[model samples]
Target: MIRTRFAPSPNGLLHLGHAYAAIVAHDLARQHGGEFLLRIEDIDAARSRTELAEAMIEDLRWLGLHWDGPVVWQSTRLGSYGAAADRLRAMGLLYPCRCTRADIAAAATDHGPDGLIYPGTCRGRDVDPAGAAWRLDMARAVEIAGPLVWEDELAGPQHATPEIFGDIVLLRKEAPASYHLAATLDDAADGITLVTRGADLFAASHVHRLLQALLDLPVPRWHHHGLIVEGDGRKLAKRRGSPSLADMRRDGADGRALADALRHALLPAGLSLTTGIGWTT
Candidate 1:
């Protein structure tokens, strides 16, 4: 069975871009007679709002979508992520790094896919574990995992080169697990055989594939689909103050008609979709 998921963080309202992504994932499963899962990625409790989460759920429902099972909340699975981190630690694949954002910005002389490539300033340092983040020893991890590859349905077969991101944090100083660790483990646990997400996160799949190999997690084929963008070509994002689904509803838009139009690619004026990988990292 082709199991897929729509995992959204509850930090902001669901916008048109989110609606498009959700429709893609929901249809991929339903059309294939498979299961569609919903996961509330609320691990960052400080930023994740319960009200926004509720509103998003209602919005998804209003959009005429359904899931096969109960939703999974990331905040409830901290222990599982912690255990995975412990396994990596035992394998000597993880190291404690006490570097803060300011420290990294000051020390990093190179940039990678996601932004500043972390310089290994804490690799040999006797960093205190009390307030340190657990970073994956990328070089050592790649060596252990050996040459790797993961395929995307749209992009075809490709090599997994996670070194571009440098040593990524698996466990945060304030949180139990980073996005990479938590999402990888959650997909496996949820039995998601196909991962559907935005093209913006296409680079992230490389790091995820590496984590799968290192942790012995199941490899899921990915579909990094087109993104919905506004007239200015900026992606419709919550941070950018895009009008949300709830906003649309409050303005008296018909929910089912909107969903139907999206399904048929009848987007509003000045909004469009593109398969272009917006960024490399």
Candidate 2:
């Protein structure tokens, strides 16, 4: 059976981009008669507000997207991520790096879609534990495993060689689990067979695929839908003044309008302003 999830970061309001993702995942699961799951990716507690997290759930439901089972919160699942990191550590795929953001920016030779890839300054450096941050050893990762492949629905096939996102951080300097690690563990644990999210996360799928190989989990099929762009041709973001679903609902806009807007965003070539697609409230 097909199983999927909508893992929102809970860092911002559920905007048009979020609604499109939720609707796509919900529709995909329903079309296949699969289980739809919800996972709160609240690893960044500093930015993940309780109100925003609650709003995410409420907004998703208001969009008529019903999920199965209780929601999974990443903050509470740190131990599992830690254990996975430990497993990678034992396999010699992990090492401690004391490199800061400045250190990486200075060491960058070329940049990819994920920005200045880590320079591996501390690749084989000894870990002081108190001073070192952990980074995945890319050279070792490449030697141990070849390029990670992801079968995408929209973009077709893609791969992320270790050379791209070199030795990514499974654990940070603060030692909290990063999104890449947490997402891989949780998606597999939730048995998510398919993943539908924004095309902006297209590179992220590669990162997640690498994690899947490292963790020995089954990789899920990916469908990276298009983004909701603004008049300036920029993707929608909270910083960009995209209206939140909560704000829209407060202004008497319902899920139908949200769905219509999402559809318009996706298929702009064949746009139609219909609000009666399959929802009422």
Which numbered prediction scores highest in lDDT against the true structure?
1
The sequence of per-residue lDDT tens digits that candidate 1 reaches over residues 1-281 is 99999999999999988998899999999989999999999988778999999999999999999998798898889888988988998999888998888999999999987899999999978888887898999999999999999988888888999999999998887677898999999999999999999888899999999999988999999989888888888899899898899999888898889988887778989998876563222
For candidate 1, the per-residue lDDT at 144 reads 96
What is candidate 2's lDDT per residue for 56-155, written digit by digit as tens?
8988877777999998888888889879988998998888877778888988887866788787777767667675667878678766767678787666
Worst 10 residues of 1 by lDDT: 272-281
Q: Which run of 10 residues does model 2 get worst, by summed lDDT? A: 272-281
Model 2 — TM-score against the truth?
A: 0.89
N/CA/C clash count, model 1: 0
What do the candidate models score in CA lDDT, each in turn?
Answer: 0.90, 0.77
- List CA RMSD, all candidates: 2.2, 5.2
